[model samples]
Target chain A: MPEAFLILILFQLVGSALQTVLHLPVPGPVIGMFLLAAALLWKRSRTRTDKPASSFDSPALSSLSRSLIACLGLLFVPAGVGLVTQMPVLLANGLPIAVALFGSTLLGLMVTAFVMHKATRDRPSPERIPDTGGQVL
Target chain B: MQSLSHTLHQIYARFLPEPNMETLFWLSVTLAVFALGVRLQIRLGRAPWANPVLFAIAFVALGLLITETPYGTYFQSVKIINFLLGPATVALAIPLADSIRLVTRSLPAMTLALLAGSITSVVSGVLLVLLLGGSHDVALSMAPKAVTTPIAIAITTQIGGIPALTAAFAILGGIIAAMIGETTLRRLGITDWRAHGLAAGIAGSGIAAAQVAQRDPVGAAFAALGIGLNGLVTAIIVPLILYFLPG
Candidate 1:
């Protein structure tokens, strides 16, 4: 159980370290998750070919996975509590703060949309009507 | 004598000087708090403005009050949550990576858009605050209101804004952005999940994705990407901007 826990965190650490170093637009956690998934996939593949004609796989990892899934939401508690400790500051700066936040979302949406549209402009939309052969050129 | 004894019990309960538990203690408490967060969401679906983070805040306070636990005792155990947060935050990279094809294809537009989004958010916030004659601290914090917590706090501190104040405002900003996001996107005629998610991630961070996940999982996934990547960008860019912005 402890081994699995350590493995889970180690991949996350690697992902973050890489993100910091590479300056990828991608987040570290996403990378870590991918790495973890890759590792798990690799392990599964390895076990499939080794003494697996009639061997049963380990149940411990499944239980551990279930525990982690169950505890997922709890991870945000500290930051959430940190919010309460800072309320006085919030009430004082509410309006301008609101403007900044809402405004940013709008701006980001516009820019991201423009970017996405431009990127995929050449690729036909999936919703486009297809020809007889199901091709939508 | 009986009444006096009862009063003494109350006093003892309220003012006990002690640390109840260590790291494991706090981690479990945090997990339980998050469980309550899930409960709050389930109880208040449809008009789903109920934020888990907000519930978490209330939960900790209530726990402290009911258990007669001191802040120090709670914090000692709570540090585990903080420690794990760093890794959990790093884990966000997984969702972000899933969008690599979109990212490489749209690099220029995304770059320009990120630059525009970051600058505009800061500029507009500052301008509005100046127009309102808000305090220097208030104005400073508002500048980074759209960014992630780490970047927001840095910008706030550098520009002579209060760091703590910036964090709180960031949360408020995230909640507000998450709230109006879907309706605003539809009204703007923007149907792309990538775009919507990008916007939510940049402006709302994790809080926004949590909300986005309910209505659109794909968008939420992309939003997670946008949050982590752009958070890193904002962290680096905003601080540098402050560094060279004439003081």
Candidate 2:
């Protein structure tokens, strides 16, 4: 239905608007995302009848969300093209920047992983959570 | 178009958009740009360094040169794709939701990490510029280079680094992260997949996310989560901190 597409676009519009209007340092789509989540959860919250929660967690809905998730890969195409534009610059800065990038990323990972691994180690593994599932992409 | 001086007039004339052909022609280039990207990914071995984004960009620049289209003219339409990038970035929230609990629990450490990451890049960027005698805006833009593009762009915009330039630098950071971040992590003996992925996301954004996913989905997913959260976190924190910091 047009409503679904509109919902998606509407979220984006609101997100963009917030970026331009409020100057939220946070990305507008992110704002729009929370807004959309609120709406979805709100709609989800209202249906408290004997009607099972099945509709809320419908396979159809999950499939749609899954595709949107998949489109995350598609979104890279444009940026990737943009990447090619900077090849000359990249080549020039390649060695030093590579050092910085890899070094920083490694350092960031060590710190995050160290803290997280320790924190989650004692807790029941995420696998125990019903919907936590297998953490596969 | 064959005549040298006439080519200039022809380009200017095309700018006027006299007929439907010109519009269609530009549309074709845009589509080709997207197609070339997909095609290269499928056709090649799909090596990380030989990424689709890199290929499309090279093709587009070469195409522009061959067609003799001015970079400005080509950008007129490509800008549409650029504009859509904002919403695509916002779409990252989908993945972010999956990690909300983890983020909430670890907010302090995560914030500390993000702040550290931002400071590392900003100080280095500005220092590099000052040391090299680059423009102040370049220094300002480079500050957020470690963060993903959208947040990086906003921070750059606020501090007056050219957004496009910042976008380029952010991608460079991601590529470098993708290329060898793993090696460093291995050398450091950080063996947890989740931590590695988180690091990849923090430093590399989506590119690193995809790279990490290729090796380990759990780590990749976490990386994606980190990318979104850090993008948001840095977007907010960097601007506020930069506001008080001596520029």
Candidate 3:
């Protein structure tokens, strides 16, 4: 578990280094997420014939990541508590903030769902999709 | 009585010094409250309003108020948990990698949905704030509220918004979506779990994604993809929009 955590932190550090070097707008951990995903996919491609032996594909890493993400909500408490200091701003603009957040979230959800449904609604099932078989490789 | 009071005060001061004891005390309090919240949420059948994060924050804030502890002190003590967010975020790769096949299968539709959803989330949010007479800072903070909290905070900082305000807005937005997301999607006659989960992830983020995961694994995968992709897209587009439009 510790080793898995170290691997995740190592990816995050590399991502931070990349962000600093390239001045990317995205955060380091996000970059780390993309890098790690890409690396996993790449590893899977190379070891398609047999069970992969790489540590990145280890069940330990998988379980560790799952547990961390399961508790992702608890991770936000500290920052969410920071809202206490913004009470004045929140109180002052409570109406606009509330409406905008609620309305826009609802709208975004609808639009995304609508588009995704429209695009895929008419398509045949997964078995018939041409890209389903070997697109990743 | 006076001597006894003085002796108790001295004992309290000696045993619970300012820095070390305070850290342990606040950390314990935060974890305990959150654990209680998780149990309550489970008991409540994982209702949206009983969201553990929301519960923990409200309780902890009240605790801080009653104890006369500043937000800064509580945050400083629990900063270790916040630090783990980075690694947890990086850990998202595991699920994303696991769902790569599903993602690749519907790449075009997913991309289209992601783009439409991401753009709408930013434009609609910022425009609504401005039109509703909110200040520029408030509008900026609302811009990334649809993204997950960590990425939302980073984007808010980049765009000169209040990160704290953005975090609160993002979490609230998530709760709101989780509350209404399913009914809304169902009313729209969208039965596809993939669409449902993607919508949850894009607009509702982790909070909503967790909700989706409760019902369907396939939808959950798409939801994870939604969170990651929306974060990436919004991170790029919001800055670009600000740069080109200067709003």
True contacts kept of each: 0.32, 0.26, 0.75
State the DockQ, from 0 to 1, for candidate 1: 0.21
Q: CAPRI band of model 3?
A: acceptable
Clashing pairs in 3: none
**lDDT tens per residue, model 3, B1-247:** 5576566556645776789898898789889999999888778866778888988889988777656577998898999999988998898888888888988889999999999999999999988888888989999999889998988998899889998899899899999988999999999888788998899999999988877777666677889999999999999999877665445
| Pairs of residues at least 3 apart in sequence or in different chains that clash in candidate 2 | A80-B53, A81-B53
lDDT of 3 by residue, A1-137 (tens): 78888889999999999999999999999999999999988988888656657776778998889788877888999999998899999999988998899999999999999999999845533321122211110
TM-score of chain B of each: 0.78, 0.81, 0.92
Which has the higher TM-score value, candidate number 1 or candidate number 3?
Answer: 3
Query: Per-residue lDDT for B186 in model 2?
Result: 73
TM-score of chain B of 3: 0.92
- In order, the Cα lDDT scores of the candidates are 0.59, 0.60, 0.86
| lDDT of each residue in B15-104, candidate 2, tens digit only | 746535555665576567656765665566445675555555566666665566666666655555656555555445545554565566
TM-score of each: 0.69, 0.75, 0.92
Q: Rank the candidates by TM-score, best first.
A: 3, 2, 1
Location of the lowest summed lDDT over 10 successive residues in candidate 2 chain B: B129-138
CAPRI verdict on model 2?
Answer: acceptable
State which candidate, 1 or 3, has the greater DockQ: 3
